[model samples]
Target: MKLGIFLLAAQFEAGDQGTVLTSAMDAGCAAEEAGFDEAWIAEHHFVPYGLCPSAVTFAAMLLGRTDRLRVGTAISVLPNTHPVALGEQAALLDQLSGGRFTLGIGRGGPWVDLEVFGSGIERYDEEGWAESVDLLMRWLTLRRVGAEGKHFRFRPVPVVPRPLTRPHPPAIIACTSATSAALAARQGLPMLLGMHADDCEKAEMISAYDAAARACGRDPRGVEHAAASVALVADSRAEAVRELKAALPRWLNRGLSAHQTVDGRARTMRDPHAYTDYLCEIHPVGTPRDVIAALRRTTEATGIRRHLLFAEGAGRPERTLDNIHRLGKEVLPEIRADAEQ
Candidate 1:
């Protein structure tokens, strides 16, 4: 199994943007040092849930900071940005990083981010999202490309610095629903499952994706699917849970509540404490053995081999770094051993 870190850049403490950002960077460096395969950056706007507004930009920085580690956007919100421009950035990063970049895009929520970025609420719709992803794919793959879609109208342009990865650097779609899974399958790309869903739900989505791929005459057997899960390692399960319960809920409560819809659409926010409990139940936490078992169960259920572990559940950089180290030292070896079997 390939292991990676999910860098959310979540600001857990008030007025600590710089510290949080630095910690995120440190986490990426630590991930590489800890022998991780990749570090995926999260994109969020006007919220502390994730402070990085431009995942690609942040990814570029992380890529430069580490030589062997592959860097990617857990998702660069497609609705709020121009696909061609984003594609160009991805290609540039891929080339510079020696093909160590992965571009993961998603149809972000109907949040005020659309208004702030002047993308309009219409861009958040199904049609707009599909068009953008298609355009992006073309940009990454074709030498010269143009788009004449409902949301974009552009003349053919050269794809400069053409990605070092043939066809394009690896592209993943962050998907939660069956519709999005189908889209990813149709595009012949893999899905980046989130931590919010349990293993069974993830398995269902994978099934949906496989069905869609088969219907579209595409084989899904070789796709390297990835899933994000929370990780916090301690001497015991109770200690790990205690550490996460004390801080993660507060961060979730503040960050989730900060989201505002552009059209005043009702967005049901989860109860942070309850959600944390749910994550603890589904995700890998506690001792290395416990984490390995959790991850093994998830892998078996979802047929996933790549894992993006979110190790900042304690909302402290030191603790987060410790988790990364332990993950690489204790958990990764066992996971690889199990995979070999």
Candidate 2:
């Protein structure tokens, strides 16, 4: 199985922006040294939910720092940016990195991002996202193209400095819903499944994606889907649970509140134990052995081979570093070995 890390670069506390970004970059370096395949960064605006607002810029910084590790945007929010401009930036980064860049694009969410970015909620629908993706693919693949779509219109123009990876670098869709999964499959694109989904949800989503791909006359086996979850590896399950009990709730509450609303109030989970129980049931958060078992169960359930670990959250940098080290030294090899068998 291929292993990667997702750098949320979350700012959990006030007056800690610099520390958060520095720790994130350091984590990227550590992930490379620890034998991770890729480092995916998140993009968010006007919030500490994710400190990095421009995943392409952050990806450039990481690509400059790492020799072997591929750097990608977990997603660059599509509706807020111009597709042609994004295509140019991605192509340039792919060239600069010698084909080490992947463009993961998505319709960003929770309704608040659209309002914050001045892209009204009306534009956050599937039609808008599909139009953006269509324009983006055309920009990346064609030498000269013109679009006459409702959302975008332009004269035929050539894109300079085409990407290093021939037609363009690989593009993966961030799939959070069944509609998005089917869209990805219809386009023959891979998907990055979010960490918040349970095993049953993931299985259903993957099954839907595979069926959609096959229905589209595309081979489902050719699709490379990744499942993401918050992970921490420690000496024992007790140690892991203790640390997670302190940290995961903060992360979950921040995430949930940031992404959802009820009657104009932010949604939140107040009970840490209940939230932690849900997390332990869904994520790979425990000792190496426990993580291995959890991941094995997930793979068995979903048939996914790529696992992306969100190792940084409300935890301290030292603890996050330790978790990465243990994941590299203990969990990854076992997962790979099991995959071989």
Candidate 3:
């Protein structure tokens, strides 16, 4: 199985922004040294939930720092930026990284990002988001493209710095819902499924994605799907779970607090106990042996080949490096061996 680290660059303590950013880059270097294949970074705005506002810029920095580790956006919020600009940036990054860039796009949630970026919530709706994705693909693939849509209008214009990766850097969709899964399938793109989904939900979603892809005249088996989950492989299962349990609440609560209704209702953030229960139910946190078992079960159920390990969340830099080390030294080889067998 392909293994990668997901860096959220979240700030949990009162520290200099430079320190947090440095730690994130350091984590990417560590992941590379530890034999990880890729490192994906998240984009957020006006919140400490995620410090990276421009994933493309951050990806450039990491690409320059690492020699072989592929760098990508966990997601570049589509509605928040222009498709043309994004395509140009991604193409340049792919060239600079020697074809080691993956462009993951998503219709972000109804959050402060939209308000802060002045991208109205309407653009985040189904129709608008679909339009954005279409335009993005056009910009990436076509030499000269024009589009007339409710969300975007452009006369025929040339897109320079075409991506080095044949058609374009692998463009994957971040699938959070069934609709998103269908969108990815229809576009013949892979998906990045989040950790919030349980095993049953993940399996169901993957099945739906496969069916949709087949309906679109694409081969489902050939498409690569990735699953993101918090993974911490420690010497003992008890230690791993304890560390994860201690850090997870902050990440969950912060996410919940960031997205809320106009009427000031924080639905998911209200219940800490339920959040903890849900976290334990979804994440794969334990010793190397236990994590491998859990991952194998997930792969069997969902046919996920790429496992995006989110071991850097909740702002624990030390723990993040340790998890990456243990994953490389103790877990990854076993997982690869099992796959080979």
Candidate 4:
């Protein structure tokens, strides 16, 4: 099993974005030092929500700054962007990172971002996502796409500066709903399930993903099924709770920004209601021991193959990076050793 981290670059408020970026870069270096497999980042536009509207560019920047840690766009909203452009950006990042990029595509849900950015919210449906993703994959891996779908079209255009990795860069679908899960499974792409309010949904999503994958003539075990959740681990449970509590309001509200997870650890506060009834059951909070226990429980329930802890939210950059350091240093080593054993 692999342990991952999703670093959120919350674009909200004044004097926070630069600090957050610094903190994230620092944390990336630390995670590499601590020996984690992948470091993911999410995207958002506008103020107080997320400053990182460009995950691929930021991913490349982080790649330049870090060594060893694989950089990922924990998710890039593929349905909203032109597939060819997205592919070009991803391939460039893969080359820049020495083939360390894994693109995580999402259907997108935040209305504010779409409405404001004119991302064609009318096409924000299941069919739209499915078709767009299909085309995006074809373009990303095949280099030359000739797909002429109802929504998108291309005339054998070849994207330049192809990925440094062979064939193409490995990809993950940020599975949220069952429909999305089915899409990912059928495509044989890896699963990067994010922001589940509870364990049951995580289990349900993973099961749906696996069932679909198996049904699609592929071995479910061969595809990655990683669990992404909001986390806040500390030396003490009280301190961990305090850090999350401080970020809870912004992390939970919808109007704050276009994000999906909160807690500065695992998931986003997609709804304006904050963690509410859904978060209490799923987010991994408290001391390192508590987080480990929650993880064990989640694995027992869902058969998760990878665990990704999110450590970004409406908080000080230093504090967020500190949280990552604590998890990497005091927590993950034992789990990795245990898994090896």
Candidate 2 per-residue lDDT over residues 1-341, each given as its tens digit? 78888888887656668898989999988999998889899887766677888999999999999999988898898887888989999999989999999998888764566666665555567887888888898888888889999788889988897877876688999998889998899878898888778889898998889888888899988578888888888777777778778876776566555664212545444575686777766888777888988888888898888888989843788877887888999988898898688
lDDT of 1 at 181: 96
lDDT of each: 0.92, 0.83, 0.82, 0.73
Write candidate 1's Cα lDDT for 84-164 as tens digits: 889999999988889999999998799999999999888888888898899999889989998788889978888886888
- Lowest summed lDDT window (length 10), candidate 4: 260-269
- Ranking of all candidate structures by their TM-score, best first: 1, 3, 2, 4
Greater TM-score among 1 and 4 belongs to: 1
lDDT winner among the candidates? 1
Provide the TM-score for each candidate, comma-separated.
0.98, 0.93, 0.94, 0.87
For all candidates, the clash counts are 0, 0, 0, 20
Please give the lDDT score at residue 232 for candidate 1. Answer: 90
Q: What would you estimate as the lDDT of candidate 1?
A: 0.92
Worst 10 residues of 1 by lDDT: 332-341
As a TM-score, model 1 comes out at 0.98
RMSD of each: 0.9, 2.3, 1.9, 4.6
What's model 4's lDDT at 35?
73
Model 4, stretches more than 4 Å misplaced? Answer: 11-16, 110-112, 115-119, 254-281
Of the two candidates 2 and 4, the one with more favorable TM-score, higher being better, is 2
Candidate 2: how large is its RMSD? Answer: 2.3
